[model samples]
Target chain A: MPSYKLIYFDLPGLAEPIRLLFSYGKVPFIDQRITKEEWVTLKPTTPFGHLPILEIDGVPYSHSRAIFRYVGSIVGLIGKDPMENLAIDSVLGAMLDIREAIVKLRFCEDEAKKPELKKALEERYQRTYKKLEVDAGKNGGYLALNRPTWTDVLFCYNYELLRNALGIDVLTPYPNLQKVKKTVLSQEGIREYLKKRAPNPMKPKYELQQDL
Target chain B: MPSYKLIYFDLPGLAEPIRLLFSYGKVPFIDQRITKEEWVTLKPTTPFGHLPILEIDGVPYSHSRAIFRYVGSIVGLIGKDPMENLAIDSVLGAMLDIREAIVKLRFCEDEAKKPELKKALEERYQRTYKKLEVDAGKNGGYLALNRPTWTDVLFCYNYELLRNALGIDVLTPYPNLQKVKKTVLSQEGIREYLKKRAPNPMKPKYELQQDL
Candidate 1:
């Protein structure tokens, strides 16, 4: 197996999925977390001036989604074929759209704009989740497949983020999505990782480990 | 071969890459262009309520990037290995970052904030292009490899957008990127497609066919 080293901040933001993938496969890696002060100096050295870089063997690679896909390939969590991958990528894209809206709301500096942003985000996610619920129901409690895939894991993280970060229970109205989270959490490797992983510094109250 | 149908607006915004891929491979697809009036009726019917949906043998798929990757795979423009895909995806991700900044700037409702957004976008693209220049130089004019991949085609479209939409000649500073554009435009299939494809409704002045 190739040596892997993942570098990011201490938070369980974008890098958490990569870490979960590594843990799911029981693959050994150096999970290097840096402080904001250190990131100021390290940012210049990174390929795209971003965190969550995975160094395979010795070469550094950026882009969180790219790294997630590569790691998913390594862990046998990715789709079996091109068509299957298309399914996975579609769901991933929808989740990302919601995440983008949440990020926009989180970073809005104007106090007067928060309610409108939050309202738009609610509408967006509700619509997306309605479609995702049907997909999960058809796939037998998974997002892109009958069996668990990396997208299910991604949904689990997103579920946590919506709850902890935004104080929203995004999965309650959809039983199938709830099932997707349960299926992902039941995986042995994931369960073990959740138990041992560090709490997200930003949102300490609702870690996945708490559920485990 | 499966019957492919690409549905999008008349503008060559997101769906152009998919169209270019099909045209490059000489694959037949229904290039369905809908007006804003048509979109109102079509939006709720779409899987994710978005334009640029691709129906593969009658099953519709949403998400532009997902469709792009699927078409790229069908046309044999994707990477041969996971590592190669990492390279392609890294460059694709960078280009997407720039695109996002451009979109944000374009949609800014506050005229007073446009200057700050524009300055930030300029700095962002310049820094990104410097890194991409070295990569293209190393790859012998392509963004990810020695041969043109789908990302090179994406760059060509982005190049046109930057030029005609934003009135910025993005490739002027980077000879290697200019070479990349030349290399993509020289492809027989791509050249044919450009020669016959309809002019971008949004940026009619700088249609890529002009370069051909």
Candidate 2:
């Protein structure tokens, strides 16, 4: 197997799912986190000048979603075939719609205009979450194919980010997704990793550590 | 095999790549183009209330990128293994970064800020195009691999959309991508589909018919 090294900030932000996948599969890797100052110097070295890069045997692959899918595949979190992957990838893509909404709101500088952005974010989040809820229910608490796929990892990570960022308990209404969180956290590898993982300074409100 | 039906607007927009892939694969699909008036009634029934949906045996799957990947797989544009798919998917994802920049500028309705957005768009386009040029050169004129894949399909489609939308001929500077476009367009299936396809009203400046 090729040596895997993940480069990102100390915070979970984008790299967490990759790390979580490594742990979930018991794959050994170097989880290298750089400071913001270090990121400036290293950014140019990346293929697309972005963080959350996965370097395999010194070959770097950027684009978080692409990296997630790649890592998810290696860790066996991806589906067995194209059709199965489409189901997983489609759910992953749909969650991006929700993530995009939160990201749009994150860029708002005007304090007075935040309410409108938040409301729009809430509406989008709820609608997308409701769709995922139905899928999760169909899959028996898993996000896709009635098993734990990378979609579950992505969903849980994005859930906290979107929830804490939006300052709302959005998942309270969705029982199936909550079950997804439980299913993911129940993994032995993930549980051990989370217990030892450091608390996130950026999102002190909720981190993977909280699940442990 | 399941019967494939693509539902989208009368315009190409997000649905073009799906159509192009089907053409490339030589698969027959019901190209269901509904007008804006019809979309309202159809919207409520869609999974995410969006167009560019692929209904397989009447089971609807929305989200354009997800649909593209699913359709791409059926057409044999997807990679045979996880690693190869990663390369194809990463290239597609990188192209999306460029596509997003162009789309953002396109949606800027402020005439006063148009120049700034245009400049930023050009810079982004040039930088990303240069990177893709390098990849194309390495992969023997194909974006992801030496031979044609779904990455080529996505790049060519996004290239035209970004080009006509920005009113700029971005491909003239990159020989490799030009080769990529030619390779995709030269496929007998894609060529025949383009010839028979109607002109896009939204982008009156350019259409697939122009290449044909």
Candidate 3:
């Protein structure tokens, strides 16, 4: 296999899905976590000055979604057909929309505006989760298909972020989404990876390992 | 061949790239443009209540990027290898980032906040365009490859939006990006489609067809 090294912040923000993909496939990779200070010096050298860059065989590539899809392809976590992939990708896009809103709310400096942002985010997630819950239910506890795909793996990380980082049990209302989390965590490779993975420094109160 | 029907606003926002892909491949598809009034009734019927839904063989699919990639694959505009696709997808992701920022700036209701949002968008596009310029130069007037890909086609629409909707000649500083636009516009299928496509109702002042 080509040498793989994933570079990102220590947090399980965007890179966690990719890490899970590699671990699930039993593909060994160097998980290079960098500090903000180091990122300052290394920023200009990056393709888009973004984190969660995956270097494949010494060639670096950026964009977390792009990296996630690439790793997913390698790990056999992708769909069997174009339509199947499209179904998975659409869910991925929805998840990204939710993630972006959360990031915007988290980084907003205006304290008074936080409530509005939070409310907007809450509304968006509610609409999105309701739709996703239906999909998960129809797909037998998977996000896009009856079998677990990378999107389900991504949902697992997103679930962790919603609960631990945002301190909201967003999945409580969506039993199928909760089952998605369970189904993903139940994977032997994922369980093993979570058992050994480092606790997220940013949100230490609830680790994914505890759930596994 | 599967029957294709694309539903979106009359404006060439997210759906244009999918149209371009279908046009490039000489694929016949129903271009279903709906009014805001119609969308209000149709909203609840949609999977995610979003537009640019592509129905393949009567099966409706949402998410523009997902549809774009699916159409691109059919049109043979996708990269040849996994790594090559990664490169193209990275550029596409960057373009999405730019588009999202533009959308945010456009929708900002606060008069005082508009300037700040515009300035932030300006800084972001400048940084992003500079990086894209280098990629275009290396790829011989294409964003991610020596030959035009779906991203090059998307860039054509994005170029028009930057110039018309935003009223910014953002490509003037970047000769390579300008060349990329020229290269994409020169494609026979693209040229034909642009020549006959309806003028964007929102931005009638400048149309992509005028460039062709």
Candidate 4:
């Protein structure tokens, strides 16, 4: 098997899910984190001058979603069927939508404008969570198929990030989301990975050691 | 096989590549378009409240990239090898980066600011084109391996849109990009599809209708 080396920011911003997938699937990988200053030098070396890059063997691949999909496929997190994959896409894409909203808000300079942005995000988040709740309820435990696919890794990572780091109390609106989190965290390999990589902040919203 | 109906803006926008793939692969599909005002009314029904939805036997698939990948797989545009697919992802992801830069400039409301936005976009476009030129030269005509994949469709579409609609000279800085465009447009099915699809004002920055 080709060695997968994931490069990203120190925070779990985008690399966490891939890390979780590696751990969950019992795959070995190099989780390389660089400082912002180092990224300034590293960016130019990247294919698209971006981070969260996955290098298989020595070849590099950029784009978080694309990398996620590739990793998901390797770990059997992608479903066997197309429809199941589409269901995964729906939730994953919605999460991307949520991330885009967060990116938009992150660029806001005014402290006073933050509350409005937060409120807007909360509204969007609740609506997304409600849909996820319905989907999770329908699926038994997983997001799409009964099996835990990459969508689950992504969803679980997102939930953990939001709840642990963001302190948003967002998942409280969706019981199924909370349940999914518990289910993923309870996995033996993932539990051990967490213990081994203790105190790693899995979301950008959280500072080091605070969420842990 | 499931019947697929792709719905999007009346103009090409994000849905064209899927249409192109379906046409090239000779897959039967319902080509559905909605007017701007119609989109206002219809958007609410869409997942994430957006258009460019692919209804696979009445089940809706939103998010352009996911739909493109699904269709790419069906059409054999997604390479046969895993590494080739990863390379394709690199190219496509890079194309998306360029497209997003163009999108950022597009959202600028101040007309006076457009020139500055355009200038930044031009520099970025030239840089992206240069990188792609190198990749294309290194990997034969296609971005991934030697065969034309969805990366070609993505690049051709973006190249045309960047050249025509965006009114930027993408070719001047990167000669190899123009060559890749020439190679893709020569494909029998792709050539026919472009002819029948009407003049995509969305076509790349440099392509003429006859070239399609």
Query: DockQ of each model against the real complex?
Result: 0.75, 0.70, 0.66, 0.48
Those runs of model 2 whose alpha carbons end farther than 4 Å from true positions after fitting are none
lDDT for each residue of candidate 2 in B31-143, tens digit (9 for 90 to 100): 99998889999987777767788899988887888888888888888888777887888887777877777777788888898788878777777777888899899999898
TM-score of each: 0.96, 0.95, 0.92, 0.89
Q: How well is candidate 2 docked (DockQ)?
A: 0.70
lDDT of 2 at A21: 85
Model 3, B179-212: lDDT tens per residue? 9888777788888888889777775466667777
Docking class for candidate 2 = medium
- The candidate that achieves the highest DockQ relative to the unseen native structure: 1
lDDT of 1 by residue, A1-212 (tens): 88999999888879999999888888899999999999999888888887789999988899998887888878888787789989988988888888888888889999999999998788778888899899999989988877777888888888777676567576779999988888778889899899888866665567777667
Best by TM-score: 1
Encode model 1's per-residue lDDT on B47-80: one tens digit a residue. Answer: 8887789999999999998888888888888888
Residue lDDT tens for model 4, B39-151:
88887676667668999989887888778778888887876654666677777777887787778787888899888888877777776776778888887866666777888
lDDT-best of 2 and 3: 3
DockQ-best of 3 and 4: 3
Candidate lDDT values, in order: 0.85, 0.83, 0.85, 0.75
Could you tell me the lDDT of residue A128 within candidate 4? 76
Question: What is the per-residue lDDT of model 4 for residues A33-84, given as tens digits with 9 covering 90 to 100?
Answer: 8889999888888776778899998778888877877888887677565466
Q: Which stretches of candidate 4 lie over 4 Å from their true place?
A: A81-83, A111-116, A164-166, A198-212, B111-116, B198-210
Share of native interface contacts present in candidate 3: 0.60
